[model samples]
Target: MKKHNWSIVLLFLLFVSLSISCKKKQPVDADPPEGTESNLVSAEVTGSYNSNQLRLLALAAEYDAAVPFIKYDVSFIKINYKTTYKGNEIVASGMLVVPKNMPTAPSMISAQHGTTFLAAAAPSNVPQFAAFTGYELLSSAGFITAIPDFIGYGASKNVIHPYYDEYHSAIAVRDMLTAVTAYLKKEKTAFTERLFMIGYSEGGYVTIAAQKTIETSPIPGLSLKAVAAGAGGYDVTSIVSAIIDNGTYSDPAYVAFILNSYNITYGWNRPLTDFFREPYAGRIPVLLDGTNHASAISDQLIADPTALLNPVFYANMQNSNGELALKAAFATNSLLDFVPATATRLYHGTADETVFFQNSQLTFDKYKASGASKLELVPVPGGTHESTVLPMMLNALPWFQSLDK
Candidate 1:
């Protein structure tokens, strides 16, 4: 079920002379019994990293080579826990990497993952998936790193992923945190109550969503200290407009994915032929079947969004006058209305064609205008979505680290 490749950072960075390698070792994880509060279903070892390996990962993510480094050997333990999704309680799993030994009380980090289509590559299933890299890196730094599989992945593979549905996304992470705490207690692992949230792309959206949920309805035990969101489609409406106005987008399949998701989740019941053109109309149902790898569809589709969509549908997608159903549904997840009080940094590449850099700029402006005191947008000049990955992560790790100091 291995899917995401967070290690893409290395490959991306290496394009400009990045060269590094390392090894690591650790004891296999001990099995734990199913417990309460979001029960800990299992904790199995995935991989280990020596100090050098940890340092390599840090460097690959563009972490400052000058920052004093620590060598806390790290290992991945996939934890399956109980969480609610779309109102039904279900078992979900995620990656939890920890140092072989603990200090007094280490900080906690919720490393929300970016978009992933394949179930196997989820944090809980495979240790080497690149998405686990950040978790491992943080764990080596003495942070209890948690990465939820979200829905439609990990233990809940059969469940439909809510995509940008912020409500369900927030609940899933919250429940996962509850499960992590319960498991840590059962293991007698020492960790602080301080929590940080960070992620990229879809993960970024989930991070913001969770921050909003915590602020709007503060959780008693979990306190959020800081947040970092990178290249997420925060302004949902603006994203739609970008697709329509540009006549093309970096990923046309996303349009189909979103349209189909809204139809199924909201019961719009809009048939494929109503929106898509030709064989694509017939092919989209299976392409978006949730069973295919995300790229399986995107790779097959052309970047020209207009080519994939029917004329009427494309025209309607241009603005609010048409397709009221989707507009309203996307509105529910838009971050424009939510003003995060926590020290939050929004990072986006000025050259990002996929998610659009303007998303962050608009969010920062609205937050400031709406009276949010602790919000800032960090722009990575000339960085594309992929190129910005390491920089965004590097920015977040230190910002979170600074909070404790």
Candidate 2:
């Protein structure tokens, strides 16, 4: 395995994580020992699901009858690997689904999953329904699927999840690849050098971020064949800007997750009152303490997202420069600033209220202007953020298969 540039990564994270949420703090690289790679801590055969099971997932995810029933049974493996979370070495768990009888070397598909609050719903825990359609459809479609539970989930759920922060989650994906590689080699499974990635919602953001990490710091022996990112907040700056601009956002928990994760990740240690208004301010930290479900967090905060935010912080969001640390972080995570060299496809719905459709549009335009000819945006008609996930994925899976062919 190739070691990533830790100093570079830490600098990026530090600049992205501001002192108050814009001042550049001293770059502190808390990365575990350089030699600490993905070591398999445990392994288990969860269960084997048949073609019918996969088909049911497709139907449930997207009523696409065109989804093929390959009849290939896939056995799931729960795997734990060593990875650094905010510089701390932790054993993180993820799931791998192998085609029961693949004749040739299967290709690698690192499907970064969307946001989920339940620890039991982590990929390693629920192979069948962890993220539902992404795991089942892609894993059963003849590719070896690997999904990381991410930090603060699965085996390491005790810590707060780094929501919307791409740096740590991308490292988790990279280390999980190491674990998956070890498992494949130990089992004597044949796999080609090709690697593909797909992510939706939060997954989409991670996919693009991981791809960027791979680009800035290439992973040895891994060739990213293609990327299908759907409904992701690719341009974190723009998305965060939308949140600030909006009056009443549908999902307030996402905002809370961003604040909480950034606080812990940057070591700011600011209390909830620093970001939120009273009552809700005191209530948010409890909701975000890695215990309450995302929906529960949403139910608890019904006011306009702006209403829930501190007046000073809400107004600071307007500054695009280093005036606000949160805005700086957003600019750092935004994907539009750089062009993807790999063949990439971004999918989103036109009517996405949750993520706002303009994110994809602006990103696509930016890519086009950057001379990235291979990148294209696929728009789903009348699809909101929630509604477009499956539809975008249905297209993404086949698109990945096409890339392989």
Candidate 3:
């Protein structure tokens, strides 16, 4: 996974255009909208930025003089909505961005964010650094952007984040879009009703998972237009298998996060020692408690699977017949079986070490062979896991804009 801070800087620059004034734009707080309906619990305008401000920021950040032109002022709203988790209904939170004063109804994009270890980095919680998030920049491009905090952040912070669990991740997004639609309608805001999805890293996984959910189980009045996912681990089983086989992987925190998340999310309750070595096992729970940064956790843990994992557990993970329950969990969460039903672009840095590039390769090949004609695999030449995100957006945004037209 890309370091959280790097992703923030890169994504913010990619979307917001860079500027020194990128410092926190004080939110223009508004009274919470009245008459909340359906799954929408509450909505409040947190901040607003004009086109000129974005343009200046863009000019400051642009490598060349050319930057994405700002067209509309954007407003960010922090919304609390009802969604399901572990089969129980719970309230979730996300950042909602709307274009102000558009002549025509703007389309919607549910932008899922990459893996973030700090609770403060959750979309709804980052108003102080909202410009850096990049989702708001999509709003300036005239799309209503819905960015979920997923569970385990914002309103549902008490719950352990489901991480790559398909159902939870997908449902958080799907339900947020639903709640946003209802809220917009209630507020008498005009929107196109057309929808798109995009994300990178864990966000990418959530994007695809949400697409599968939206496609397989129809959302009323919300047809998915298209999606672009970059460097996502769509093939969980294959990813884990490769990690064990290779015996070395970068970003031990990511691997640990998945293991710890699955243990809690699935009710496995496996001891950390079952997954990691001595001091590391004891250190992991504290690291993942929604506090430490990803790099901090990684610094504390070794990257060698043999050194990090228990010998028996490591051996079992590799054996086809071993770790059946864990394997089943991975297979259950993997996206390999589902071919996308709508236009889908899977982007990967050819050099991504965090989530192996093969995951996308295998997924694309499977989708193509399974007759997904609209599917496309975009390999970013020499792009590492972190470097691929910007190019993916540069390529994807135009494709999405063309479709929107």
The best candidate in terms of TM-score: 3
TM for candidate 2 is: 0.85
Candidate 2 on 1-405: residue-level lDDT in tens?
011365335433432332223222232222323455436666676666667655554544444543673557777777787888877788888888888786676798998888776666677765323334355557667888898888888888888888788778788888888777766766667888789998888989889888888877876657888998988888888887788688788888888888878888778888788788887888887787655667799888754866888877776666544237667777777777678899999999898877888998899898899888889899999998777776766677777878785
Q: Give the backbone clash total of model 2.
A: 4
Q: If the candidates were sorted by their TM-score against the true structure, best first, what order would they fall in?
A: 3, 1, 2
Q: Scored by Cα lDDT, where does model 1 land? A: 0.74
TM-score of each: 0.85, 0.85, 0.89
Global CA lDDT of candidate 3, please?
0.82
Worst window of 10 by summed lDDT in candidate 3: 58-67
Prediction RMSDs, each to the true structure: 5.3, 12.0, 4.3
| Candidate 1 ranges with C-alpha deviation above 4 Å | 1-36, 55-70, 128-133, 288-296
Candidate 2 residue-wise lDDT at 84:
89
Give the Å shift of residue 349 in candidate 2. Answer: 0.6
For candidate 2, the per-residue lDDT at 321 reads 42
lDDT of each: 0.74, 0.75, 0.82
Q: After superposition, how far is residue 292 of candidate 1 from its true place, in Å?
A: 5.5
lDDT of 1 by residue, 20-137 (tens): 2322234223344354343556666656556665565555555544124445886667777777776777888888877777655788899888777655667775434334435556
